[model samples]
Target: MMRSCLFFLVLLGCRTLAADDQPALRVMTFNIRYGTAPDGENHWLKRRELLADTIRQYQPDILGLQECLESQGEYLQEKLPEYAWHGLGRNRDGSSEMTAVFYRKDRFALLQLENFWLSETPDEPGSMGWDARITRMATRVRLYDRQTGRRFTLVNTHFDHVGEQAREQSVSVVVRKLSQCPPPSDEPVLLIGDFNAAAGQSAPYTAAISAGFQDAWVQAAERKGPSITFNGFKPVDPGADNRIDWILYRGNIEPLVCETVDRSENGRFPSDHFPIFALFRLP
Candidate 1:
């Protein structure tokens, strides 16, 4: 009887270990578009429910959003109670558009959160860098996963849509800050955003690759959906190479799959840009 009990316990232990090793994190990056923009039939009020439903369908563990105004963030917080959101606006008043990070509240504990401007004066609020058309910023967070007993960092941002030089410089600033992040540098790191630059066609994309981060889309074992992420509230062009949004990661994480979600209803999109999704395993 003792021998049989020992064997059963070992089998149970192995099963638990296998479950823990599975691809357990779902990550998504979305450019929700500015909530207050004059988008007529596509205004935030018109499509907020659709956008909420899109997020509910995926149920991502880690969600990064660009062009998220404070009001929209609050709406999401209210809508998705399972996740906790954090972000600071690019404007000095802390009330404009933001690069927001949302994590599963039940699965992770927030360790630290920081925001820096994408400008010469990173510490200054609303500081415009280079020839950027408007102020831009990055939101960084360190989170502890309760189930895996792992810690990781996520940096979310929105690069200037008009300034090539600003985008390149912003990449440099982010890379430097990543290296300087506290709590040591060995933890896993993820960078996600609407970069406004397509892969292989922009200096910032090249710089991110050189900095040792692997694009999750490129690293995924399986892929789904369109090649481009931006839609401009129009039908998806299957042949377009306008993949400006991206999810990049480094360290011990493995991307199992990547996808661009192009779901819509009644000819209305959730947002102007399609949200990208990825499934990852942390060992």
Candidate 2:
């Protein structure tokens, strides 16, 4: 009887451990170039289906997209029924580019969604900051993972491509806004976007690191594909590292694998920039 009880106890513990160890969450960041851009052969209508196919193949649980115009966002929404998204155009009348966040409807529940500009007046919509060539914004979402019962925050942003100061200030603005969230700073947080600044070569990256966020690419035990995340609709050198898109995280998350997706269909590519994804587990 004593031996049977001991065996039962061990089995119960193992089951508990299995329950606690949830499957790794797939997170991706994509900068699908604005659909309206005049790219001759690389027009939006021409490659929309292929772009959608790439996303369908990966099936990320959470996705952050930059350079998404209103029409492009709507098209993606129609194509991907499994995901629920929140975003706003970066213009006062909502007619410009957007930084959007989309999450699997069945896997996560949306708790809160907020949009902010990267200016001194962050609360004001469509506000452009110092030295910025164009309006920039961020989409912040608080989510609840139904499978793991974990609450976390995700921030999707597009920093100004022309403004050096604006990019650095954008990081500071995001970090400050996060701090204002109701206590318990240790909650898992994910920041993903087209930063427009290469890692280790810009102030934005340095500021993020100073604020305690770890790059998922650096934290992953396994890495895959090329380091060049931007291709400009052309073939790129496999060894060159020119990544402007990134996934940074803090709190109780372990990055399992990081990959820069370098997939192209035939001679045509999906977008000007390649998508990056990381598989992470909440511990």
Candidate 3:
């Protein structure tokens, strides 16, 4: 009898441990600068490998990429077979690139995928807004975690860096759309991408925060440096500042780790803007 009781206790402990070992979802956003340069080096082909390497290093479950062309998206998809991607083609003029979301296939199953332009009449798909700096779009997806049976929405976008009015209007449009999304649970909604707005006092930033979202950097305890993600191909200069790229979250989620990745391996930046990653727990 004693031996049987001991065996049962051991089995119970194993089940508890398995439940506690579930992995947290890792997400990252990167703006690859359409894989070009001002120096006229035309190093996208070479840099593509480096970009893939940097992403592979993190092994994020979901990755949001801005300024990606259809060809570039295909290249990344081929390189990272573990991930599945979704995005719309460039705008009518073939100028605005795709905003893509890549997810690890083994961990999460894709539930839904949709894209819409960030214009005054967003429902019309390709409509452009009044302020035309560059066409903007947002990609939304529903991902289900096979391990925990958790589901959430991930929205990725790129706002106009040049047109201040467009950026502000875009923020309102995005928030309204997200507010209406019906997720499986009150599970967290993650908004990731190149926001193109600096931290503090910016209208877009203020609007987003006021709309019940929190920046991951501010939630972190040891938040250090300028928090500027735009490195401009230079080695990360701590003093040179602008915090444009971001990862924001909503609902009952807590950020465990948040940091900007310096992909400046071997004195070369993977892109003009560094990527930001955040690890979160669903409570």
lDDT of each: 0.86, 0.85, 0.76
Per the 3 Å backbone cut-off, how many clashing residue pairs does candidate 2 have? 0
Residue-level lDDT of model 1, residues 1-283, one tens digit each, is: 0000011111111112226557467999999999999999999999999999999999999999999988999999999998999888888878788899999987777767778889988778889999999999999888877666677789899999999999999998888777665445556799999999998758999999988889999889998899899998999878777789999998888998999999999999999999999998866
Q: Please give the range of 10 consecutive residues that has the lowest summed lDDT in model 3.
A: 1-10
The lDDT ranking, best first, is 1, 2, 3
Estimate, for each residue in 19-45, the C-alpha lDDT of model 2 and write its tens digit: 446656899999999999999999999
Which pairs clash in the backbone of model 3? none
Off by more than 4 A, model 3: 1-22, 36-39, 93-96, 222-226
As for lDDT, the candidate ahead, 2 or 3, is 2
RMSD per candidate (Å) reads: 9.1, 9.6, 9.8
Backbone N/Cα/C clashes per model: 0, 0, 0
lDDT of 3 by residue, 105-176 (tens): 776777666676788877565667767576788888777766566777888999887888888888888877
How far does residue 211 in candidate 1 sit from its true spot (Å)?
A: 0.5
